[model samples]
Target: MPDYQIRTLDDADIAAADALFLGTLHLPPTAAEQLDNLRPSYVPGRALGAFDGDELVGTAMSYPSALAVPGGAVPRMGAVSRIGVRADHTRRGILTALQRRQLSSLVEQGDVIATLRASEATIYGRFGYGVAERVRSITVNPSTAEIRPDLPRVGRTRLIDAAEAETLLPALYEQIGLRRPGMMTRPAGLWGIWRVRETKLDGLARTAVHTNADGVADGFVTYRAVKSGGFRAELRVEDLHGATPTAIRELWRFLIGLDLTAVIKAGSQPLDDPLEWSLVDRRAVGVDGVTDSTWLRLLDVSAALAARSYGDAEPVVIELVDDLLPANTGRYRVGADGARRTEATADLVMGVAALGALYLGDVAPSTLAENGLITWSGEPGQAALGRADRLFRTPTPPYCGTFF
Candidate 1:
């Protein structure tokens, strides 16, 4: 094992961290240039790098943000991004050391939880990060899809230029509120990257705003069109947000009404999209795929458990094993009242990472138990697991619309 020191990143280290991050993915420098243009989200004294005698081999960056959980409580969370290890440093324990240092720093800084979008599914479990949220992609044949008359359509949508969108969208998102459990408040750096500087979406995408009956901007969808042939066109959605059910319906109406567009594709949509039910022909909406989005790690187990609301079920004692953050290893009694450390024997045993996976109510405890990710103290523990599942379940499956 190489002796490497993990420390906070500074202004002088940005270029080096960016280079190694891009280099690890085998991407060109153009990507780094694109990253440079966006406002840096790195929190001072939180961005960490593992250096082997001053040569940077690994980097992980974090920023402060509030993560919305059940019962409408938003807790301060650490949002980690651009985590990577130099190609040659793989399997050498450098990644582990960097994560440990980052998690430790977050705990000291009073962050209750840490979250990241994992590039690979298998990479972060050992570090106590769990898949806390999921998103799905949908393909709609717009020409055949029809909105049912019963669904209220009180809003009128109109196209807006990029500059106008830049001014309105951020405020619209705030007005709409981060109402979902897994949703987050987007920082200025992320908004600048997505709405202002056209990187992945590029400059071709157009923004459409939905106005209420009183002519107020409430929802918007950013999408782009591509002509594949003389008669065929496709509309790809870049981003979409709605403040109300009527706003959502109106926005979809506008998207489907666009002429020459046969196929409409959108990703990162909530699992319970009303567009499916709004259609006259339900089969027109095809679910292309679903993938994990937000990976959460509870930096402070006691605080994390107490932050979110639970169901009106009987309390259950859980024994959590945290390999990286050993201080979190203990039994906790969690229920509708809130969670607290308890000296009683645990009804269930799970890894800290597994607990994080269930923190946002994305996956149920019973489901994890069926998959052997959880261990019960008794043979027929279905009742206890059922109660725990209800306590952790949310009205909608957790979905994080914000990328960072």
Candidate 2:
């Protein structure tokens, strides 16, 4: 018999769930502050608990959100977060059961996809989640970094207080539409936690805004400084948003120009951020880290495939092997126009996990084929794979700025 049962979390279960999640991470709750900051964001019916009779052994939840895809398509997605299972319950089927319940619920609610930031690299692939986005950690030496002369700037910058930042940043994020794939809408509750509850400033991180000649805000950056050594400090950026390329350039220039700060470091930067290219010495900016950021699982494969626009290429039929969602186990023809179910023989075959990775256009077909993740059917299969690559190519790599 299964040792635990999975069900929707209730109000009474909140404390236990929070305790389990925080305890597993070894963080104690604040004495003066409760999880009141998280209460407002608690999505009713979206959280699930796995219980060993009266005891809660595991927890997981998802916030309803939309994920921006290539060609300006935004699909309804469930942002999976706040997941934890008690250490003692390790290797039990509890986690698998909870995941199955949540993912199934997401599909029933018509969610096209589910995305999560995996705590470990090894856990999610078995559940059909594939690495769909990447983030880079960058360190820039401000003294040696100079903006290239040819890079034009149209905006001036000014500092702002945290109060002003909380009021203005979200609006600017909305104004800067999700032009790139992998970006998602930051819901209001998350904004509250990010600006007020989290960060070193304790809700008062130093903020700066970029403004055009007319004095309209186009970009903003939130960062804090820490003394690293004698006469030197590190400016750690919390978040940076730009409405345009000029805005991005201006904000970056301002951050690197801060006095007393010898180095500026930021995590979760888009892999394609042009900060290095715009600098006089590209070597001044070092990629200190790189890692997979978002893992995506397609719940409704047909709708997921049709939601995003593709590149100009001939339609290619590929057979999918989906054990979790058996309905997706079939052949589909995909092209620049869109994707559709097809009865024709598939030229290529792959598991759903591999398909999710290819969905973002970040993983090339050639790479997948070389890695043995893809199987070719005929002599013409190689050409079909080529066509698939063209259709999935994106001008920019996919990146999700939101952490959850």
- Candidate with best TM-score: 2
lDDT of 1: 0.84
Give lDDT tens digits, candidate 2, residues 1-404: 27698999877777778778766767654332545656644578888999999899889988888899988889999888878889898687777888889989999888999999988999999889999888999998898988887877676899887678777888888888786899988777677556324532332258888997678888888887777458777888878888777788889888877788878888989999888888889998999999898899999999999998898999999899988878889998998889999999898998888988988888888789989988996669999989989998888899887775
Instruction: Give, for candidate 2, the lowest lDDT window spanning 10 residues.
Output: 195-204
Candidate 2 error regions (>4 Å): 30-34, 150-153, 195-204, 228-231
Candidate 1 accuracy as TM-score:
0.93
Worst 10-residue lDDT window, candidate 1: 194-203
Q: Provide the clashing-pair count of each candidate structure.
A: 0, 0
TM-scores across all candidates? 0.93, 0.94
Measured by lDDT, the strongest candidate is: 1
Residue-level lDDT for 36 in candidate 1: 47
